[model samples]
Target: MDSLSLIELFLSALRFAAPLILAAVAGLYSERSGVIQIALEGFMLFGAFVGATSAHILGDGVAGLFMASGFGMIVGMFYGVLVLKLKADQIVAGTAINMLAWGGIPVVSKMLFDVTSNTPALEASERLPNWVPIVVALTVVAVTYVLIQKTSFGLWLTVAGEKPEALRAAGVSPAGVRWIALMISGGVAALGGALLSISLASSYTRNMTAGRGFMALAALILGKWKPIPACIACLLFGVCEVAQLKLQGVMIPGFGVVPVQLVQILPYAITMFLLAGVVGESRAPAKLGQS
Candidate 1:
């Protein structure tokens, strides 16, 4: 590839990877605090809808972005209350949230916009620039790494996840820690959603997240929940996506064009391979899913 093509490829990879990196880092916070936040998909979807709606109404991308994060925190807190305080099944609660968000968006969109699935398309000036999401993702990754690896709060999180009873004996409320972690997780996931709407697509569509949240979960597992590794894994997945998009029309001597289905399978295949011990065993928090 020429230098210009190579640069374009790298930029595309960064754009594709930005949301995944944000979601994975967010997942890290919740999972490390002993909560299995499988509902990140739902949170992201909600955030995207909220961001798009707010941006369309207010004509300010930053306001929409913050609103999305706020909505995510609210939803996350609800999830935490259901799972942690009421002792509901974490998996069921998460799945329910995803179902609710995925279904609710279309209804809301139709009611508000008189359209089937999305708000109006945003102008370029009204959307967050692509570079903003990339910078935010990189900052989040760096900050999360430092927080988890070099701070007292990080130690508390580890202890709470590993041994809640021990944390209680030490006068820390493990439930509180988990709640905070889940809120942060939700907020970050929402940020990813906002990035998708405002930076990636500039429009809201039902199910626009398109399983990126689940992909983030896969990256988290593949990276063994470490910040740097998770970032790397997300970048790899992003590259796969970028390649799929870029090669859509390109023809080679032996292969006329690669099948889109095959490209779509790349990330999942990598996930399976990583889980099969190619990247080493993944260890969840000791008390993950425990009430």
Candidate 2:
């Protein structure tokens, strides 16, 4: 309604978009390197739980963030071994990873804190500054752009996904390239997940991600897998989320009041529309998901 309100709304949108941007870029790294990463949701959930639990134990949020990244990488490496070494179906492996996170976090939480869902609330000093995640997300975007467009490793990644045999002929192991890519992906997505607990919320709650990982996938598709465009798509989805929050309970001249459930579906609804419109035109790497 006013300039101040608009600015606040924009800030809120940025905050909401940070995790999506992080995870979308992370997914880009994996998919662009010929590894499908449907397990982003799982990676993020693990990070959230680990980040919260570690921070609570160590009394330090930064330490928790590192722990989250470490665990995420471990899981990512496991995923790589399953898909690349054992030749497991990438989609199936990723789905299993997601299911693992859904079930595992609670079990671990119960073991550690005697709770099966959430960790204790963190103090302000124990949480990340609000600016930290926003800055980190943007930095990752710039770095990803450089990594993909201005580096030899980037070239190798492209070849690994589009023509793995070419990379192998060049004396590079395409599997190695993919393994590294997935590791980076997991670490980045873990940062996004840590931000959920240490920056956005004070504690890690069960299923708090609430499909943001899938939304990030949609953003990745909408952006055509490019870093800058994916960030823009994330912002767009963030706008949808903020609109959902802002428009709920508002009176309409002819519609009375907006339904909260419908408002809540704004981001997801937009994602479905964008995916449907682009799926036919979008093209993935030639060798993506190939063993």
Using lDDT as the measure, which candidate wins? Answer: 2
Q: Which candidate is the best by TM-score?
A: 2
User: What TM-score goes with each of the models?
Assistant: 0.95, 0.97
lDDT of model 1, residue 25: 88
Q: Please list the residue runs of candidate 1 whose C-alpha ends up more than 4 Å from where it truly belongs after superposition.
A: 2-8
Taken over the whole model, the C-alpha lDDT of each candidate is 0.88, 0.90
Instruction: Report the poorest 10 consecutive residues by lDDT, candidate 2.
Output: 278-287
State the lDDT of candidate 1 residue by residue for 148-264, as single tens digits: 889978878888889989889989888888988999999999999989998899898879888888889888988887889999999998898887787776777798777777777
What is the per-residue lDDT of model 2 for residues 84-200, given as tens digits with 9 covering 90 to 100?
889999999999999999998999889988999899999888998878788888999999999999999999988999999989999999999999999998988988898898888
Backbone clashes for every candidate come to 0, 0
Residue 56 Cα positional deviation in candidate 2, in Å, after optimal superposition: 1.5
Task: For model 1, state the Cα shift of residue 192 in Å.
Answer: 0.2
Candidate 2 lDDT score relative to the true structure: 0.90
